[model samples]
Target: IQMLPMLVVVCLIPTVLSHAIPTGDKQQLQWISKTEALHTLETAVRNDKINCVVCSTIVQGIRQLIEEEQVEEEIDEFLNKACVTLDLAAPYICEALINEYAVEIYFVLERVIFTPDELCGIFVD
Candidate 1:
């Protein structure tokens, strides 16, 4: 039946929801939250599934977040309105920042935060 496809997708929703986030590596990217976005990269790298696929995304996200001003504005606004200070705020910001350029923002800010680049070199290293 033509309806079989839609029924299959519908049937899978609960299963998908049950394990919403795939544990190991996929092209999928996790969102960023914390004083700096590097924490996201750190977590991703530590995870068995995320470490490999994440390097390029981390570099790309960091570059994009800083080079693009509009994205920067959006993230700043998100931080303020979303109560980024709260622990619960992580998933919300993570959700909002999924495609946003946060790693780049963190990269750029590192210069401001650390006079000695080596201290923060762990990010790119």
Candidate 2:
């Protein structure tokens, strides 16, 4: 029975090793292409006409907070403050989007916020 377990593990080793291979040139190229596309989309979002002053400021703050590698608590605090500021400016915009778009607003918000990973997904999909 011990030998059976060892044999099973030996068989699985090759499978695991095969999957562990580093991304090859083709995969690397694809990733680089996607990354470039993501950057283009981010630039477009930054220049997009839909951005209000309050929304733009919050988006900028989020980008800055992420770039600065702040702690999770600080990021949450910053976002809370941003929301409060936004509430004072135009409270109904977010509500309108949520009420109209519902689940689909995630895609819109992802574009508006423009994080690299999220943008990559938005661009890829």
Among these predicted structures, which one has the highest lDDT? 1
Model 1: per-residue lDDT, tens digit, 1-125? 42322211111211211122222244765543332333443344345233323333333333334445434445445433323322223555434542354444454544554322332244333
Best by TM-score: 1
Tens-place lDDT per residue, model 2, 9-95, is 111211111112112243563222323423332343345422232233323333433345544444333333322332322334433
Error of 1 at 46 (Å): 12
lDDT of 2: 0.31
Name the 10 consecutive residues with the lowest summed lDDT in model 2. Answer: 9-18
**TM-score for predicted model 2 compared with the true structure:** 0.26
Which residue pairs overlap in candidate 1's backbone?
A: 24-49, 25-49, 61-104, 62-103, 62-104
Which residues of candidate 2, in runs, are more than 4 Å off? 1-51, 81-125
Model 1 weakest lDDT span, ten residues long: 9-18
